[model samples]
Target: MNLHADAVTVLSAWAPSLGSQESLRQAFLGFLATRDDTVQRSCEAGHLTASAVVLDSTGTQVLLTLHPRVGRWLQLGGHCEPSDASVADAALREATEESGMTGLEIGAAPVHLDVHPITCSLGVPTRHFDVRYAVRAPAGALPVRSDESDDLRWFPVDALPAGSEDLAELVNAAVSSH
Candidate 1:
């Protein structure tokens, strides 16, 4: 089967397991089956990627981003690219690039998997399959803003900004697992 067909097959098999949040599930399945060359190229080029949930010294605080485009606070992450040798590497790279924190230690297991819709300049939606990993931020690390984010800050797991429930859950899971 072709890539699109294979993607569809994979999506169909997994869609039933996605529970509610039908829109998110459908978009995720659609993303898996996308035949658009641009989208395919983006994924293939590693521009469609994964990310990390960096926990600070106390493990009570998690670093997050105030996204400029989506205008929402979220975990630091981005697309996986050709230079990334592995999924963990992609997550680490995105964390470093987006948060400017060095000496990050990525966890061995994925805490959660989420798919979100991102609309670019032309108002077309792209899907991001975020594979979230738990990570430890370097001691005394300070988060700095990058091109992808407007601001970076650390927030307590239970006291995250409004609308950050999903991120908070993921971060909490990661922390608990550790």
Candidate 2:
């Protein structure tokens, strides 16, 4: 199936843990129903993005990136590309590239959904409908910082950096279900 079909299938099957998330899912589905180009970054209204809350093999650590543009430590993710087969593929690809880890495993369904406004490379303000997944890295995984991020590091699940409350919520939801 195509990326749009894959996104619909995945989002349709996923059961959000919170009522708020379910509402977002319904909103996303609604957006997709009218905007077939929702997966593209050029979509002026807003676009869907994929992200991953990466956990260590023991599930005690979470890897995060200091987003260059956002200037805050956040989970690994980005806009969908033509090369990405599906939204899940985009999430895994972003996670692996940003973390530089080889044996990462992603969950079958997304763990969280968020909608935030930003002025990205498109140079215009738009909302990012972020679909986040829980990904697990190898026990001995070592990360190499990619140019895409200012920094990439793993922090204890309980003690993320200051002002990372948003990521904390995503991590908590992912850890509980991971």
Q: Taking the tens digit of each residue's C-alpha lDDT, what string does model 1 give over 1-178?
A: 4433433453344322224434544665555545433223254311234678889977989888998987989888776555555566778888988887788888865566676566544346665566567888878988888888888898988889998876766777778857
Error of 2 at 116 (Å): 0.5
Candidate 2 C-alpha error for residue 160, in Å: 1.1
Candidate 2, which ten residues in sequence have the lowest lDDT sum? 165-174
Q: What's the C-alpha lDDT at position 77 in model 2?
A: 93
Best by TM-score: 2
Model 1 Cα RMSD, Å?
Answer: 5.5
Candidate 2 global Cα RMSD: 0.8
For model 1, the run of ten residues with the poorest summed lDDT:
38-47
TM-score of model 2 (CA atoms): 0.97
* lDDT of every model, 2 decimals: 0.67, 0.91
Full-model lDDT, candidate 1: 0.67
Model 2, position 67: C-alpha lDDT score: 88
